[model samples]
Target: MSWTGRFLSFARDERVILVSIGLATFGLVSTMITALTMIRDDNEIPPAEPKTQYITQDTEDSLQLDTLEKLLDHPNFSIKEIAVKILCDRAANDPEVITYIWFGITRPDYEERMDSLRTLAVLTSQTGNEGLARLHDEKAYSALVRCMELCMQSTELPVVTDIHWDEYYLRDMGERFCLMFLTELINKYGATMLVKAKFVEKWLAKQAWGNTPEERRRNFKDYMDYRNNRITDIVNRIKHSRRGLRALEKAGLIDKESSRRRIRELPDLLMEVEEEIAAGEQSGEQQSRRTREHSAEEQRLRRQHREAMVLNDGTRPLGREDIIERDASPA
Candidate 1:
């Protein structure tokens, strides 16, 4: 039989085959219609897995530890991104994760590391764990500082969500984290790191708690007054010892009547020292050239003077007694 006649004979006895084909076709058409409907629907999402945030003490502790450990293995960008998403979604407090994140900043692979740092910044601010004060690396410390500076400048009320209703809670946490970070820097590195890092002074003088210009402008006068008051408080704290003031000066983070002259101004202070060194080198070279020139001039003048003396000897007459004695003795 021909192939077509054989195929027709094969299906002619199979009513089940026709039903199955029809059903398969219907299924495909239904799937296509459903897909089109989904595409047209703006709000359709594969219903998100219900997120469970930790509220109790133990769960939070566990989550934090888990995230902290996860940080060590997350050298890959994709893994770290996934880990942060998980941590932020759960809104779990993990002190270990917080430290790990800060520690991550010191890692060489930290070019892709900002996500974890930003996550820690948000977490520490949310949980109010003062342990964030333990972070000491200058760069990590600065990133947290910058994040807090930004958070404080946000004028918008906290977003009300099914999760968080109190804006101030997060704000307070952020403020605490920032203060803790600064306080830790002051306590451990004694603010000298901040000054040497050139971050503390810049942020203190111009930027608001957040680095935004508008916020700084809005809060500048108030910050100035507050800084004055803060200085007074610092002075009182260090009232007993010259060492305290010296430490502040060394850090270059403080500016006041006593500490003002002590704290080095950023660009000018460093530049002036460099310029002085350069000038000294240049001066030394010039001095050496001048010294060689002066020596040559002195030698030339001496030669001229000696020649003049010789010429004078040749031009002038001897004493009359000497000449007479010489001529008499010779005769």
Candidate 2:
């Protein structure tokens, strides 16, 4: 008989077949019951945990963090808002990312710098002591001072004004909260909180004017002077000048070793110095002309003596003692 017919016959007519079928059914039912029991027991199987990924350069899934680092360079307003969201959500804990964000605040694009500063203030407020303590260094305060200045707070308060928070009304609470916190800090401690440490204090002194538009424009000019070989490299040549070097050393914003390395990388350090010298020369020339105008009589006598000497055919006095006396006479 075929295998199928034989199996059917065995199952239908044999006691052995019936016994085997009953056992097979029992085993299958028992296995299902065991599985259910195990599932119901909390400790029977180890629990599975949801996976979490931290922010990093390689993180492709986090669009906000990725875009925030590049927000200062982007022209789109919506993209910047999305970037702010991502930064507030994920990159707050990452120092490098935070530093990159600070760069945007320090050297921003369009309103991106302003937007980034608002986000930073919000994060600072939310993180409280934990975040503040971590950022107690000079660089953090310097950046904060600049941000506050940009917001028009003379005291460099952490609290942001309506001008900063409500201007665009991007509808993001995170941005508003940041502005509020910053404004509050400024309102509470004024600019002192911004210049807490001695190093930061020194940086504040040097960059005191840096927050102002005019001062920043001047700084840009100074930077250009340095770049065009007008003045000394403020970072390098100033190393020996008491005010310059001391300020540089006390500037916690710069990593000393790193700054030194960067200074070494640069080709010249006295571009601004040259500019200053040139400016001085021009001023000196102007002053000299003004002096000659004020002493016209004396200048005329001196000029006459010079002309007479030149016309003397390389020898002899112009008109003897009278000419000499007139030339020597004070106006």
Candidate 3:
């Protein structure tokens, strides 16, 4: 017989069953080999470390006092906060920590600068001789003045978002903290410090609050309030002093003519603030009236639509729940 004839005979014979079993056996062995190869490859690969473990290891192994000080300028606010807190705690025992905190005020990172200010506040708030000494530190005073000057010169507003809202809020808090700290310093050490920094007149001037009208309007009330409070504090100090203007003049703390000018102009400045506040109130009322009118108009239109729907359907008006149910029903 020919080979084709023999193959045809094989397809018709029981031996075909043996051939099928052999093919099945070959496939199973090939599959096992592939799976074993994959298993070996997986075993050779290294496992990845958890992110938290990596961070913990890095901090514990590599972070030193100087490293933490440098971390104050880190982009992450949480990192910066941690660094500042660590540095502040160290400042109590090591005065060298204060030097790092002072330099942090001059950093380009606003969060770092603000955190440094907060640390200084805590350091200065310590009771007894230590606190007194920190408050009197000329270097601390100079750093504080430099921080205020830098803040005043910074006209750019950071973009506000949910992620950045804390930074924005801290910036405002920092400004207020700076002012309050300055007030405390003046009260304790006198205005000579400000005079020496040549910031006395700048503080007296109307500060640039914002770049736009909307921003200015938003900040107007708070800025004016704080400014008024600061000026009032200074005026009160000058007035309550034992020898008054003459004593201030003799001590060369503040210019004699300048003090007289500020006193004379105080009433006019206060009257201007009151008038502006009244105008803002009136504007707000107008806006509220417009909003109420708009709401009423929307309610009226909704009622008309409901009435039309009832007339067209020849039935009771469809309520919100009824409409929702009708729409949700399977077609």
Candidate 4:
């Protein structure tokens, strides 16, 4: 199957979202600002002694492409740094390399994704290759944006028959992958991600709660109705099981059946029914508040990033020196 086919299967699932649109878009923005943007002002980044020696020769393509990609997640920082440098020089422009990088990151492994981000962060600070970095940035961001667009265009909303609606999956993606991994670099170094924070704000505001709370509530109501129907079907099946069993006995001497299936599934179905009942229906006011809270959170994140400049660095983030100092600072 193609990447598109595999991607859709994940997207349609209620418990999983593969390289989700929101998260991927957020990741692209994160890389664009922090990883791709070069700091030019010397004042923002004071000179520091280079801890690692520069490579005299262009050993960029020296390592086999497959081997170099593996080094991105190597246990040692020095090895990972070298791999980042090598890839930034040559492999950064290669489509296969970019795809390989994305494929690695899209997995469910947290440590693996962070290691990838760490490599990108290193590439952002490495000097003497502005044009190459830009090339990489453009290609990577464009492909990610395209992927996000494809997800949005997908008509694969769960049928809710074989599957049930669950907001938890999106929450998982936001917290685990998008919020945690993407923000790891900025938070660790105390660097301000002003653009990234803003991007997050805008993206969140585009959610159901922000733009059309009433419409969203109506949609949820429809979903609730569907849930109710499913619950009813299960309840009827459980209550009428004995009658069906009798009818089967009359039809034939009745083959054996697992009485446990009905018993075991009953508790979960009942729980879902009770939860749905308690949830009742969403109100316009509640939806509006959610939207406001998201907007407020965006403000808070922006301010936090803005103030982080002073705390993370002596000055606002601008040049490569700031990163070097942050690296040199004792953990």
Candidate 5:
């Protein structure tokens, strides 16, 4: 009676265990199958439609200049960029295109303004079509000045926490593009265009360095270096131009008196720029030395405070006054 009862009880327990294992296995397989099905469905789903329809080069080329100009004001950034590219190509031949593109600087959209600045820069660049003299006309120069003024007005740097960071970033990009355009113009025509030099000097003077004193010092040094390099480039260009003027004078194509006057002016400009460069280098070195001194002082204070903390045996942190007193009283 005891053997039969034990056997039957063991058999019943084995069946319960087997059924529980089967149920658990079935639940696991069900979950795995559900997940696999979800992944397969996701893979089968189509991608989202693009914001703007893709235009082939042929299609873009077929678009009228007027149509492209109108697209400059489109809300879609890509559309504006395409318009600017087309306009840049057209502006190489058509002076009227400059008129259309220059007005883009006044556009409320930062993207449009940036694209316009870029296009204008390309048009007036040294590598650009030299035959398009209108690219450096008073109207174009005025547009550049207007763009620079806008940039200077919005020169306040944006932070990550700022809600207008995107706008600020775009504006900053536009400013850089405008500055490039102005630099190209200055290099190519500065020998004759006194206003360009004066305007650039004014713009450079108005530039904001940075938010913090340390940042200001570092950025100012970099700014001085940039200015020094720019002036050096101008001086070199003047020297090259004077050589060309001398050649022309020898060839009797240019009046000797006029060429001599021009040559004399170039040397004066070169001397002025050299003096400015010398001054900038001296100022930059002083600033850098002061910054280094400041950083060293901060490091010394930090190291002394750390030593004071260790000297306290981790029992209590020393206050600034205690650290100063400890340093002052002891060797």
Candidate 6:
């Protein structure tokens, strides 16, 4: 008989068994298909995590971590934001990534540098302790300080005159990123902005451009003398310097009214900041002195008490800490 005919000719129990076998096979196949569907959905959807593992280079995924790393300054703000969020969550402690972000901020490309710094500011704000750990990194601090110097904080300093350079490069940078940096660190991170300001001042005036103390002093003096004639300097350079002042004004380091946009008015504002810093330093010194004096007095009283106790007991008196340790030891 043909196979179909044989199945029809089977006994009742055999027919039942055949039908049962067909149902079981169908169920197994359906289960496997469902499981595969779920897995594909998981891969296609956004992950619950803020940062995902970098897809391997060989993977067909277009959004590889390494690729995103290179695109931190991408013109599309969303892409850069995504890249930074991923790096901060997944690679928050990576030294290499930190250097990449910091260097990216200081890059010569004005627009790119500004974009990088904005990302970095967001990053440092979100990473908490990881950001704090980097706060003390001297190299990172110096790079940031250099970036801040690009701000024309002192109008009498110098004008950027490189023909190939963007005339307002530093000004634009200061407005968008550098000034924001100091304010962010101080307000959010509680950084000592005054110390950084002093550092930048010293580097520019003495450390950056001279040999001996006399030579350095002369260099700074000459620099001031050159910019003495503010009106003669290009308008764009002065405008850029104004942006620096605006940044300072935003930082709460300077309080200036909008009515005063004149370049000559900046010196008085800078003097206010200087006096504020000096007064803070003086106050800090006085507090430290008081603390030292109090500590010394406590030490003297303890020593005198010990001497009196020794005489009374006819034995050398031990310090309270020493006595506690002696008592705790096995006899």
* Clashes (candidate 2): 27
What residue pairs are clashing in model 4? none
Decreasing TM-score order of the candidates: 3, 5, 6, 1, 2, 4
Q: How well does model 1 score by local distance difference test?
A: 0.44
Per residue, candidate 3 scores C-alpha lDDT tens digits across 18-105 of 8898999999999999999999998896778777633554554456867886787799998787676555544666767768888988
Overlapping backbone residue pairs in candidate 4 total 0
Off by over 4 Å in 1: 1-134, 156-173, 207-331
Query: What is each predicted model's overall lDDT from 0 to 1?
Result: 0.44, 0.45, 0.53, 0.40, 0.53, 0.48
Model 2 residue 78 CA deviation (Å) reads: 24
- Cα lDDT for residue 73, candidate 4: 82
Say which prediction, candidate 4 or candidate 5, comes out ahead on TM-score: 5
Residue 97 displacement (Å), model 1: 4.9
Q: Report the candidate with higher TM-score, 1 versus 2.
A: 1
Candidate 4: tens digits of C-alpha lDDT, residues 1-331: 9999998987798655644767888988988777445544433667798796665565554667798879988999999987877767664556665567565444455555445544544444563445223423333433332332233233233332222564424432212333332233322222122121232223222234212444443443344345543222222232223333233223222322423343222222232322342233322121211112246555453333333222234332122222221122222
Question: How many steric overlaps are in each model, in order?
Answer: 4, 27, 0, 0, 0, 0
TM-score of each: 0.27, 0.25, 0.36, 0.25, 0.35, 0.32
Poorest 10 consecutive residues by lDDT, candidate 5: 285-294
What candidate 5 gets wrong by more than 4 Å, as runs, is 1-89, 121-127, 157-171, 191-198, 209-331
Q: Return the top candidate by TM-score.
A: 3
Tens digit of per-residue lDDT, candidate 5, span 199-315: 434443344544554554455444434443343343334333444455434433335776677654432223333334334544643221111224655555434443432223333
The number of clashing residue pairs in model 6 is 0
Which model is ahead, 2 or 5, in terms of lDDT? 5
Residue 81, model 6, lDDT: 74
lDDT of 2 by residue, 91-171 (tens): 566788679766777563537766776666667655665555455445665665555344433223221122223222332
Model 3 spans with C-alpha error above 4 angstroms: 1-90, 126-129, 155-171, 206-228, 235-331
